[model samples]
Target chain A: MLQIENVYKTFNPGTINEKKALRGINLTLNPGDFVTVIGGNGAGKSTLLNMITGVYSVDSGKIIIDGVDVTKMPDYKRAKYFGRVFQDPMMGTAADMQIEENLALALRRGKKPTLRPGITAKERIRFKELLSMLDLGLEDRLTSKVGLLSGGQRQAITLLMATLENPKLLMLDEHTAALDPQTAAKVLSITDKLVTSGNITTLMITHNMRDAIHYGNRLIMMNNGEIVFDVSGEEKKSLTVDGLIKKFSETSKGMLSDRTLLSD
Target chain B: MIEFIQSLPSPIAQGMIWGLMAIGVYITYKILDFADLTVDGSLGTGGAVLVVLTTQFNVNIYLALVAAFAAGCLAGFVTGILHTKFGIPAILSGILTQLALYSINLGIMSGRANTTISWRNYKLIVSSKTDELFFTILKLIVIVGAIIAVLYWFFGTEIGRSIRATGCNQNMSRANGINTDTTKIIGLVISNGIVAVSGGLLSQFSGSADVNMGRGAIVIGLAAVIIGEVVFGKLFNNFVLRLMSVVFGGIIYYIVIALVLKLGLNSNNLKLFSAAFVAVFLAIPYWKTKMAVKQPASKDKKTVSQKEVKGNAAN
Candidate 1:
C-alpha cells in the first residue's frame, strides 16, 4: 500500500515561470490496488507519481510506502520500495549493458551490491525463463547488449525488469507513450497481464481516456494540480469515455482534449 | 633501419610502463564514459609519493608503490567529489584536481621539483639503470598481465557491474537502486589509483620523479586507448583481450615514435606528433559513421545496414 497525505509541490517559486505542480494532494492505495490516473497536460498526474517515487520533493505533507516513511528519501534510496517505468524507454534501461545484466540489476534492487559474481548460472537460467515469457525471442540473447533492441523490445524488457523482484509498488508514467500504436497496444496488454497476474499495487498515468477506463480496478481524475474525480469497482466499470470527458468538463475549467499530440 | 631496430628495446620498455597508465585511462574513458583528467595529476602524485617515501622515509619499495596507488585514489576521490557533490562539470573537476595536484605534488616532494632514486642503492622493481632489457620487459609484461586479469575479475563483480550500469545510463542505474554518485567516485578512485601505480613505476624506471612528469599524460593515455580501439577493437571483443590490446597499443605507439625519431623528426615535436596522431585516429570512427549515414534518399537500406553493423559491435 502507498499513502500520500496532503502533499504540495511548487517549481521555481517566485519566478515568472513558477508553477504549482501539486496542491494539497492526498491519495492512498490498498494492497493489490490497480489505480489508473487520468489528466490533461499540467494536471499533476505525473508530478504525483514522481513525488511517490521520490523524483520530486514533497513540498508539504508525507509519503508513506508500506508502513515506511520515505518523504525525504532520495530517488535512488526510495527505489527499494517501488518499481518504476518512465515515458522514455531509454530512461528505464541501460543500453550498453547486456539483457541478463540489466535483469540482474533489477533483481538486486533495494539490496546491497556485493563482491560476488553479478550473474551466476542459476540466475541466468531464471533470466532466460523470464525473458521467454515476454515471447520476444530475447531469452537466447541474454548476453546481447540491450542497445541493439528496438524501442518496443526495450520497453518490454524494462517492464520485465520492474517486475523481476515483485516490487512493493509499480509505477508507470505513460510508459507506452513513445511507441507506435500497435506496439503501444501490445505493451499495454503485457502490462495488464503482468499486473493482473502478479496482483501488484500499481499507479498508472495515462493520457488515453479509453485506457483509463479499460484497465485497472480503480480510477482517479486530476485537474489543476488536484484530484477532481474518483471512481472504482462497479461505478468505474460502467463509466464510458464520453461520460468521463463530460464529467471532466463539468468539474474543471477546461475540456479533456483528444489523446492526440496535435491537440491543444 | 638497423639503428631504429637497435633503439626498439628502450621504447618497448617505456611502452610497457606507459601501457599500465593506458589501462587506467581505459577505465575512465571507455568503461565509465567519463573523460577524467585526474590522471594527469595523479600520475605525478603517485611518482612523488613513491620517490619521497622510498628515499626520504626509507620505506619499503613495494609498500611505497601501494602508497602511490592510494595517493592517486585520493586525487581521483577529490575530483569525484567536485563533480558529484559540488556540481562541477566532469572536465572542469578533473582540471581543478589536476591543477591542485601540481601544488600537492610539490609539497609531497618537499618543494623539490625532481627527486632521484638509484637502482644501485634501493631494490627497485624495474629500471632503465640496468642493462638487463629482456628480464625487465619480461617482468613488466607479467605485471601488466596481472593487472588486466585483476580488472577483468573486478568488473564481473556485482559492485563493478553497477558502476558500468551507472556510466551507461544514470537514470536506469538510479531506478535500479544503484547509488550512481558513489559508483562514480569509486570508479574515479580505481582509475587514478592504477594511473598512480604506473607513474610510480615510470619514476623508478628512469631513476627520477619530476614535477612535470605527468604533463600531457591524459593525451598519451587517450592516444593509447584510441589506438587500441582503432587497431584491436574488432580483433578482440573480450574484456581481458581488450585490456591487452590497450597495452599493445602503447607498445605500437612507442615503436612509431622510435621510427619517427629515426626518420629525422626532432624530439621537440614529439608532443605535436602525438597530438596529431590521436586526433586522426579519434576522428576515423566518427567520420566512418558519418559517411555511412550520409547516403541519398534511395539508400535507406544502406543506413540500416550501417546501423546493424554498429549494433553488432555492441556485442
Candidate 2:
C-alpha cells in the first residue's frame, strides 16, 4: 500500500521560471492495486512519479509505502522498495553489461551484494527460467551484450527485472512509449502478466487513453497537478475513452486540451 | 645497437611511469567518463609529498610513498565532492582541483621547484653495469604485474561492477540501488592512488623529484589510452588485459619518441612529437570505425547472414 498526503512540488521556486508542478495532491493505493494514470503534457504526471520514486523531494508532502514514510529518502534508498521502468529503453540498463549480469543485479536488489564469482550455476538457471517467461528467447543469449538487444526486447527484460524482487511498489512511466505499436502491445501484455501474477501494487502513467482504459483495476486522471477523476472496479471497467474525455470536460471545462484527448 | 641496449633502462623506466599515469587517466576518462585534469597536479603532488616527507622530514621512504598515495586520494576525493555534491561539471571540478594542487605541490617542495633524493644513503636506481639489466627487467615485471593484478581484482568484484555500471549509465545504476556519487568518489580516489604510486617510483628511478615533471601528463595519458584502445581493442575482452595494454602503450609511445629522436630530431621538440603522436593515434579508431560503417555489408555476405540469424534468435 502507498499514500501521498498534501504533496506540493514547485520547480525553481520564486524564479522567473518557477512552475508549481504538483499542488496539494493526495492519493492512496491498496495492496494488489494496479492503477493506470492518464494525463496530458505538463500534467505533472512524471513529476508525481518522480516524487514517489524519490528522484525529487516534494516541497511539502509525506509519502508512505507499506507503513514506512519515505518522502525524505534518497533515490538509492527508495529504490529498495520499488522497481521502475523509464520511458527511454536505454535509460533502464547498462548497455555494456551482459543480459545475465543485468538480471543478476536486478535479482540482488535490496539485498547485500556479494563479491563472489559473477554468477553461480543455480543463479544462472533461475535467470534462464525468468528470461524464458518473456517469450523473447533472451534465455539463449544470456551472455550477449544488452546493448545489442532490440528496443522491445530490452524493455521486456527491464519489465522482468523490475518485478524480479516483487518490491512493495512498481512504477511504469510510459515504459512502452518509445517502441513501435506492435512491440508496445507485446510489452504491455508482458506488463499485465507481471502485475497480475505477482499481485503487485503498481502506478502506471501513460498518454494513451485506450491503454489507460484497457488495463489496471483502477484509473485516475491527472491535470494541473491534481487528481481530478478517480474511477475503480466496475466503474473503471465500463468506462470508454470517449466517456473519460467527456468526464474530463465536465470536471474541468476547456482544461482538457484537444491534443491530449486524441493522443494514442 | 649496443649503445642503444645499454641506454634502454632510461626509456623503459620512463615508459613505466607514463604507463601508470595512463592507467590513472583511463580510470577517469574511460571508466568514469570524466575529463580529470587533476592528474597533472596530483602526479607532481605525489612526488613532492614523497620527497618532502622522506628527505626533509626524515621519514621512511616507504612511509613517504604511502603518504603520497593518500595525498593523491585526497585530491581525487576533493574533485569528486566538488563535482557530485556541488553539481559542478566534471571538467571544471577537475580544473579546480588541479589549481588547488599547484599551491599544495609548491608548499611541499618549500617553493624550491625541485629536489633530489640524494642517493648518498639509498641505492634506489640499481645502476651498476652488472646489475642494470637484471634490475631493469625486475622492476618492469614487478611494477607492471602488481598494477595488472590490482586492476583485475578490483574490476571483478561487485563494487567494481557497480562502478562500471555507473560509468555506463549513472541513472540506471541509481535505480538499481547503486550510489553512483559514492562510486565516482571511490573510482577517482583509487585512480589517483595508482598515479601517485607511479610518481613515487619515478622519484626513485630518476633520483630526483621535480614539480614540473607532471607537465602535459593529461595529454600523454590520453594518448596512451587512445593508442592502447585502438591497437588492442580487438585483442582483449578482460579488463586486466585492457589495463595492461595501457602500460604496453606507454612503452610503444616512448619507443616512437625515441625513434623520432634517433632520426636527427632534437629532444627539445619532444612535446610537439608527443602531441602529434596523440593526435594521430586518437584519430585512428574513429577513422577505422567510419570506414567500417561505409563499407557495404554485401562484402561479407556470409557474415551478414549469420548476423541476421543472431537477430532472429532474439525473436
Candidates in order: C-alpha RMSD to true structure: 4.0, 4.3
Report the Cα lDDT for residue B132, model 1.
70
lDDT of model 1 at residue A95?
93
User: lDDT per residue, candidate 2, B14-37, as tens digits?
Assistant: 776788789999999988888888
Best by lDDT: 1
Regions of model 1 farther than 4 Å from truth: A255-264, B296-315
lDDT (10s digit) by residue, model 2, range A1-264: 899999999999989999999999999999999999987788789999999999999899899988999989898878989899999999998898888878877776765455665456798899999899899999899989899998889999889889999988999999978776778889999999999999999999887889999999999988888898999999999999789888878776776665755555
For candidate 2, give the lDDT of residue B194.
Answer: 75
lDDT of 1 by residue, B1-315 (tens): 787787688889888888899999999888888999989899999999999999999999989999999999999999999999999999999999999999999999999999999887898888885477777798899888888988999999999999999889998988999999899999999999999999999999888898999999999998888888889999998899889888988888999998888888999999999999999999999998887767564388777677655533321
Q: After best superposition, candidate 1 residue B149: deviation in angstroms?
A: 1.2
Give the CAPRI rating of model 1: acceptable
Model 1: residue B5 alpha-carbon error in angstroms: 2.2
